[model samples]
Target: MTVHGADAVDAAQSAGRTQLVVGRSDIVTPLARERARDTGIEIVVGAAAPAPRPASGPATGPVSTRTDPTPSTGPAGRLTSLRAFMPGEGPPPPPLFPPSPALYRRGAPLPAHVRIDTRAVGGPGSTPTSGRVRRVTVVGAGNVGMIAAMRLAESAAIDEVVLVDIAGQRAAGIALDLSHSAPILGFSTRIRGVRTLAEAGPSDYVVITAGKARTPGMTRSDLVGVNAGIVGSLVSDAVAVSPDAVFVIVTNPVDEMTEHAWRTSGLPTDRVIGMAGVLDSSRFEALAAQVAGVHPRELTALALGSHGDEMVIPLSQATVAGRSVADRLGSGTVDALVDRARNSGAEVVGLLESGSAFFAPGLSAARMVLAMVNQTGELLTATVSARGQYGIDGGYVGLPVRLDRSGLAEIVEVDLTAAELDDLQTAARHIGDRVGALDGAGAR
Candidate 1:
């Protein structure tokens, strides 16, 4: 009872019946009939049976001529039968799956099962290709860098992670410890520790987090010179070996270091970015919750500009329970909240007394890596090079950017008040001074 392709013709020849049905309307009727006769199977072109009407209808009035019974074994029989059963032209072929309301609401016109023929649509290099991970290397072995390497090894997306550090033994020990945990975690990703920068070789992504941690007495400006020098050296080595790998800068004075790395490495601007504003914004959200007396998850806040005291926290744009915080708390309370937001990092360091915050910073770095690996193209605040964006130029600063596998895609611009603008400019000047100082020291 099952027929397939040319085998259907053989089955017809074996059967005593001389009739064949060609369902394809595109095939010329006469041509099909001829082919059927040549194959010794008579073509029944229009032998479809007519639909029966219900007998319960009253015969009160004269029936129209259109309702007349038609013969079922003529050239027009199929068309007549189709007209009786289906009023208009027969229904078009059904879609493979039912439409999803959610998808439709989101502006996706096609159903989930509607397959696109990439072969037909794709030109030259437009076709989708698989990615291979031959070797993975990480630059820096500080808190963010270590976490990035560990997370990358654990990710199914990459194969291995080579952890590099100035302190070689410490890096090796960390790698060894992470390697031991892999067995219990059920991940097969390999981890290696490299003493010399050259040992890491070419990598898919070179994450930089090797500078000193921020202390309570210091500002990001204070850490700029030391971190810039460290980042500059790391960038030089990383670019020499892994020219194509994306560079993620997570050092303190992130904006300055990121810019220095870009300039030092001579890589494209898109390849160098700093991780800060995302973490800072998360802190802002938490603080907003405390001020509003609500769960942190329900509060939404934005922290823009430099990742320091001069950073801009837009209270006018912040909201809780679908209402602006400015409206809820008025101007004075909002100003206090902004002050709290600006000093939260120092507050955390004061509370710890021994170390700066790590969990949130580590999580922020991991999120950036995940966004890149997944090609999600999500918009987040990261320190990136600027060419006259928001009236700032020739520097790196925290701004919202769309990130994906290709690195920074686009920068999002936000409105700033006069006071916020002044603060940001001051931060930029402070960073510029530190960079100048480092250059002078290097010259000496």
Candidate 2:
């Protein structure tokens, strides 16, 4: 049989058979004809013409032949070979019958295109199919707390968020606002506000931002008696509602308040953590960006010890654009940058003259919430109870902790300078004093 396409012709030529039956309809050039002749083979045009009935004898000229050894017998086979036919052949073998409808119709009761409602399989109006429906509860409805509730409601991993506040109206208003934004945020989570802690029962996580804000000229230490009492009450209520929830303390004096929360909540040490160093380090990064004239993202740093001025920033480990801070701007400038970082919070407080920062602090709390909900085992420096991890005991301190689905997974002990260690101990002692003050108040 004659091959029409260039690939087919090459394939046939490669097979060493130089002769080929071609139709008059075929477009073979004189040069190809000459080449075929030079190869000792006949290029017989119209050879595909049906034989003249045999003329009652041995077929005249050369009987039609198929170049392929296995002649086609099926309809598809006939179409593949049909292009080799001479003109006046009947309609090119009826153009192989359209793919069998029976083949597509087999087995299934109905075609796949038929839309079948899956709700019937799982019962009608059941909660939309999703992974385990995780619930989060944010305690407090102040700025930081509301912002955290909004962020959690925007996350896809959490299915529900309960916002609890002592002031029922405030929590309800914030929750309503968050719920209204769900359509815009493209999240399907439900946001609820409640007055009592009972509404947040057995949540996957509990974020405590219920304490009072820092007034002007007040150190986080100054918030001890007031915020500690507030944190203690909130912790007690939260523990009764969600003993299993991972408690994240975001109150001022976080290191001290976290210790109070753990003691009052009676949760395991691993279940209670405080948000401090991450926010502190964020401030440091911002200040480093100001000095280095680069994006804040390019600055790498860590804050340890407490959440206040006593918090130790590891200057030796700090870097800008992968170069050490000292290398980028020398030691004197680096020291100034460190001081700026250490005082950034106070600077903001001074600017506001009334309120502390909420944006970065809220974002920091949200990051911790996401780490827990998504089960991302990220190492973050959070305030946690010190069981003698860094030679400090009976207090809370900020240290790198592995956060995962279960909350505080592990505390990572990093190498520190002698001065760094001593400063951390001093900060811990400061926090211990605050905790002791709260304890004394409780005695009264």
Candidate 3:
């Protein structure tokens, strides 16, 4: 079929054509251009008469928009590399996809003065579909990724949850395994696993878990150099396809890696958050709940600063049943709990003798995913660029934030005690120093 309108474009793609000859009457629509890009089909428009179809396979050359007499007026479509002008269609395009500094350009930050409206934020625990979120993509179908993918599928908020990994067959297998559970779990959300990032398409929320895990006797910092490279490449590739997607980084050395992601993807800092504080806060809360003889759900806790051992767990602010933890538990007991929370990941790494913590991390990832997908105003902890917040500049740190569909809606700054404040300052220095180091190496 000669490609003309949207229907013909679909028909050509449906028949698996390598190239399409543009007739004098054929008009290319936006969807046709997109399909051409996705399938790498070269569109040849005739100069004077009807253009001829190419040989076989895929066509390789610049798509031309010369003095060809196709009858369109105005822009046939977006003036992009793969798209060309048609002679039909009138009036100019109304400035489509105005480039956001966060998207195309680098070194720009989200405006600091943009006020966050509380009521506009979505409810985290609210049942699904109050917004436009339809798909969630998890990069890296490893243990943390697969489990996180499963949790998103179970949420019933998204229509499709995609799992992408470099290990093609293994990721596909994990996706297949989770897909089978949908029937028993009573969820309509489809779970699919693929080998490449392009296959995931445009996702509302992208949870990046595609990096190395900490092994026994290895500090989260120890995996930084390797994982930074891994996270950088993954973010670059994933961002190419899902340009509007919000990123939730779950890779180790998360604080540094989060910064790495923001710079590499050149996305707005708020939309590229690291999943350190949520998992760390959950651990702290779970331990506090156990010690205080309360359910974890009953305890509300905040773990801020860095994501690792240096994280600031403000016990004075943490409460269970509306009662301060400090009032219930003595300083000695609370100190022990904080130590446990800081060492939680290391403990699991040692115990497993191979794999690190999966269940808790995956749950942490899912909780964060829910907050973003539902546009929940729920105050949660995430690692985002610290623009002088807690005296941290030009680096990413874990802190309390109100999440919404737009990602970090507002940075919730709870007053910290002198000691907690000091800890946060130190973490800022640590993260800043390492971020500077990464910059020197051109890691970002």
Top-lDDT candidate index: 3
- Write the residue-wise lDDT of candidate 1 on 96-210 in tens digits: 1111111111111212222222121112222212243555566667666677777666654566778898784878888898899776766677788878669877887778878
- Best-performing candidate as measured by TM-score: 3
Give Cα-based local distance difference scores for all models.
0.60, 0.65, 0.70
Candidate structures ordered by lDDT, highest first: 3, 2, 1
Off by over 4 Å in 1: 1-136, 183-186, 293-295, 329-333, 415-430, 433-437, 440-444
The stretch of ten residues in a row with the least summed lDDT in candidate 1 is 98-107
Q: Supply the TM-score for candidate 2.
A: 0.68
Q: How many steric overlaps are in each model, in order? A: 0, 1, 8
Alpha-carbon TM-score of each model against the true structure:
0.65, 0.68, 0.71
Instruction: Give residue 300's lDDT in candidate 2 (0 to 100).
Output: 60
- Which run of 10 residues does model 3 get worst, by summed lDDT? 99-108
**Per-residue CA lDDT of candidate 3, range 41-86, in tens?**
5454443233334565444543333212222211211111222433
Question: Candidate 2, which segments miss by more than 4 Å at Cα?
Answer: 1-133
User: Which pairs clash (backbone N, Cα, C closer than 3 Å) in model 3?
Assistant: 70-87, 71-87, 71-88, 72-87, 72-88, 73-88, 122-375, 122-376
